[model samples]
Target: MKVLHFLSFFGLIASLSLEAAPKKENRKPNLIKPSETSQTSIENSFPKPKDQYQIRLIMENDAFGGFSDQYYTNGSRLEFNMKAGESNPTRRVLGYWNDLFITPTQSTKYLQGFSLGQEFYTPTNIEKADVSYGDRPYASRAYFGNSLTTATEDTSITTELELGMIGPSVGGKSAQMNFHNFIGSPTPQGWDTQIPNSYSGALRTDVRKFYHRFFGTQYNLNLGNIQADASFGLIFRFGNVDKTPGPGSSALQPGPPILHEDGTGYWYFYVNPGGTFQFYNATIQGLMGSDKSYKTQNRNTAFSNWDNYLNNPTQEAGEREIQYRALAEDNGKNSLQRYILFNEFLVNGTSNPYNIGLNYLLFNNIFNGAEDIEKSTRLFLLNNLAEQWDQIPDNARALAIYSIFRPEGGKLPPQIRLYSYEVLSQFILDPKQREVLLQLLRNEIEFRDEKTYVADLKRAVGFIKVGFVSVSNAGFLFGVHYNYQTIDFQSGKGLPQQHQWLGFQLGKVF
Candidate 1:
């Protein structure tokens, strides 16, 4: 029965796509007449300006709906797009590779896009410290994506590839906990049980065709370690829609803005109804399988030993020192500790102070032909520098140190840049100073750059999305959307079978 329903859904999409599309003569004219002499007319009289490039930011969160904050809690992406032409390196490379596999199709236009995004998922009850058995696991993915789109009069096709990492290494825990702290929400305590670290990638292709002026059909296939699925959908547009030969805006789908021949601007409301057939979901089922137990055991042991050390009553000075050193080493290797450190490194590595200290550390340790230093020794020196600084009361000596470590403006070798922040952090003592370092590190991270289950899983899931888009003649764009999805999995915990969220988008074209 489930197989029949899924096949029927695909059949419906196929029939919809085959419907007689509106002819050019039947379409309403969007261009102004030259005789009207209106400002828009005057603008149209000039050669149509080409929109060669665009940048977009997309964000989605369940909290925006004023409802729950679990299961696909939050997501964000930044994307850059360009008209595909000989001048574009990404287009040339990807196009060449594409040609080797499938013959190129003739299309009126092409676009190439690149993006970086992060999203995290949690169980229904985020406040619980224990794993919510039979519910979704705490998981996060940070990925880089590349896409190529080709469009004709009333159709567009997009092929995209995404590569990323999943687990604690991606900083899901830090992102959620810190945000919750800022917002006064209960901290999510079960991230220690998040899926083990692993690399993930996906390839997806979508084909969409419009019928008349308001209706369209789409089909897509996705395959990867992260997920495997096929989906079909219908799209409807109303109001002052752009009749351009290109892709339409989607709040859930991160990509380039629709290319317009003239900067006339537009406003429209759209609805998309879709269904997906799932095969796999790594975020819920996990990729590490049996190895998950081993990793969890190690993490638990590390935390347990650290707790013991902190509460121990033995007070021998020498023994305490030895224990402290050993604990620091162990904590350094702890998954949570590493997650925090990774986030800190990414968030603080770009500050002037951080870079200055990093440069100095690199110069001494790697570039100056000094004796090679062990990573542990370097870590110890960096960690203890602030304590050492407190003993030196001479302000002149501090100034001298700052002057010696200040950045001189040449790029450091790329290999050591990510690790250099540890040393750089040693120089920062004030809370505000540390904040400055962290802000820079985050800037660099940004500015620089599913599995299916079996009987517990629904074979088909349906979703609906409604949104409005507004664009300025100056090329600025903004949109807000509401999305709802039918349950794709059965948790049997009285958790809601329906989930809804809000999405926001902002973009600019040049």
Candidate 2:
């Protein structure tokens, strides 16, 4: 079948690509530009370094036509630059610097380097039941990858190749079946109600591939003041849709199995190995940086680039002038201001920002490399925090606060302390709330001390949900995504499902 051949081709490509990566890295030439090799003033050579960390909150939808027929998505991607390479200065054809400096001075010509991070999102299905027969229910996946960036005078473009996996999608679809308490009798629908035990079974099945692979490349370009990005990739699926059978590869496993409660019939379920290739694009414009210190010192500007003012601007022309100047100097808008503010104002503290000084705890430390238990606990904490940001129970909040402020034997890490302060000091518009938070941080709880702090921080990593909303205009953007997917057995037969969407978007970045 065509599907089988396509899967084979992709599998081969994946294997070859992984095998060939290191060889290609070794083959890269170490030669650098002759002009840039010459020792120039450090100040002149290095442009202002971009922030080491970037957090992007993006909401994408294919609802340009109407809300009734569309695909919706919401997510955030956070990136951290582990190593930022140097920029390659432009060289003339036969210039003096090129002639005088012939030896290579750098390992690569790229201005920027790579980043590592996570992307998390949820996609939902909302098609009409009568007209549409597709089912694309909401699901979440966390993807991690490294993105390589190329920086120029007025532009910086980053390309990222990332992969993610998901397990069984219907493990909770039949939770009401209770096999233990059986009092069956014939009901209206010819099903047992009481005498014969009106119960089927509480069966939970999980069938998933070891590598429900989703690999794709995203190109994000910041051109002058305009920002534009696009990505294309595939989602390859091949695995068991049921329980794992001991120690074996997922490639050798079949799909899920269906069961009948009355032992009347049994059927096997399988999704032929297949893939879906998708692409997305968007553009935004606005203020780019929100760090006041960075701007006043680096660009000699006295204005802040937060979106709060732009969205709720005053009628005064003078204030508007100040905003315009700030925008011009900042180059672009900071898309994550609200996200930063949420952390600084609502998420981080000895207690919830609104409930400070309530005898909470804090643990500020990191797990060592070998602390597997601590690592797992941290992951669990992060997942819970992300999932229940607005509805976190008081007890969970207390536990998180206690764990984050937990102390070690000596001083806490400088970065940890600084980060705590940074998140604490911004976006506090209410005096009472500010006072309570400050009091909580400055004072200590009776039972929480150095010993408790050390133990907790060593065991669990601190985490919180940071949210933001912004408006920007970077460039013109439009896109379409179509998926010809196969659904589970429909009326005892397999059927093809179709999903399509067209979107046109425009925004700013600052």
Candidate 3:
């Protein structure tokens, strides 16, 4: 860029000199005729100028190989400045003529050659292949047009290389590892471009990176943010990712365990990124419920109940052995499982931040293997959906919920699934004000149904759920939900209106 600036300054002076050079007449150069015919004819036959004038100018430039000034005139201009390898002007100004041919052939040739030399200074973005009309070097020593067209107008260029650490912990191969990038571009005035700045940081187990790519997604609005190739329509993304422990790490150190409100099922969302992100989502599950020591997985709930303490009596004594035998007899089947419902609603309206949502196991009537097992599971799920849906994000809605019960485990039927999503939100509008902040919440599937279900609902029990969720950015989700419990257990039946909105939640206005 500095080179471009210097060139422009020279351009200004050269332009002014061409404009002010005297253009009237010139005094003839005193010359002795060559003694011989060969030289005599050429010297005498030279076209006599209609007018000749004295030309003189002093100049200084750092562009050439050196810095110096010298005298020059019509006769001397062609003999010295126009001579090959001699045009490195110490300081010289030549005359211009209106008659195209009047400018001696030597001068014409010199200008043409000089102009071509300037091409070396042409900016790379603008292809030299595109230039035409073979201009005389004298036409524009300033290269003003080329400068405006490309950043390559400079005669001198400088480049610098850089390397640095990035990410969470600032170490060699820890999280703070990154790659280096170099850029070659032009500035508005004409000059090469290079990387100006960079940085990195780590957050907990996550590592983050930041650097400029030549072309990113910015439309070039903010030049410094993206890559050089990104001049027109570019995009650059700031990415931060976490390190995943090896497999079975979750089974070992699951971040936080999710317990079912009821005693039946234990829900846990494992954060494992070893190879892929498995949500461990709601998979259809089932277990039989009964008295004489609840039976499940051939295990009697006589001892193993704690969600974390998996080390139960190893001796396999009393009902424990019986439960184990029963569980072992089931052919290692997934009897205590939960299912997922595809469409769960969260926050429903434009202004209502406090919305409702649900996580359900939408039973496919066609695939319901055992009607008895499927119905019992579906009923347990309906009650859960009615209470938990539309109560998380506050703005959405929920269609249903899925619940699983294992009778053999001596645990109560528990609600195990809930649906939620990351949604963009807007703050309160004054009937007209626009929003500023943008929020993104991604709801990914971690679990799916992979097994057959079995068992039956002993008797339908109804309950109301009262809870409010204050989500980080979207606001608080509220719900007042209730479901019908069977007054008549035998032939289960209830009026549609019998359901009630037992609870409700207020939302965050901001």
Output the number of the lDDT-best candidate: 1
| Model 2 regions more than 4 Å off | 1-55, 62-65, 69-83, 86-139, 151-157, 161-164, 167-510
**Mind giving the per-residue lDDT tens digits that candidate 1 earns over 164-266?**
9988899998888888888877667657667778898998777777775578887777789877888888888886764542334443454335555545777
Error in Å for residue 52 of model 1? 0.8
Of 1 and 2, the candidate ranking higher by TM-score: 1
TM-scores, each model vs. reference: 0.56, 0.21, 0.14
| Model 1 ranges with Cα > 4 A deviation | 1-51, 87-89, 92-107, 245-252, 288-290, 293-456
* Residue 316 alpha-carbon offset, candidate 1, angstroms: 54
**Residue 473 CA displacement from its true place in model 2, Å:** 12
lDDT of 3 by residue, 141-177 (tens): 1110000000011110111011222111222111101
Minimum summed lDDT over a 10-residue window in model 1 is located at 294-303
Tens-place lDDT per residue, model 2, 1-510, is 655565567568867986886655447674765344333333344576443322222222223323222112222233333323433222221122222322333421121212121211111211111001111222223344334433222122333334432111211111111211132311111011001101111111112222222221212111121112221222232232222111101100101111111112211222222332112111100112311111111222112332342344555534544543432221112213423433443446434443222111121111110111234555655565655556644544544554443331122333333234334334332565445444443332111121110000011111111111112122111112222222211111111222222222222111
- The residue-level lDDT of candidate 3 at 74 comes to 6
Candidate 2 — worst ten consecutive residues by lDDT sum? 186-195
Candidates sorted by lDDT, best first: 1, 2, 3
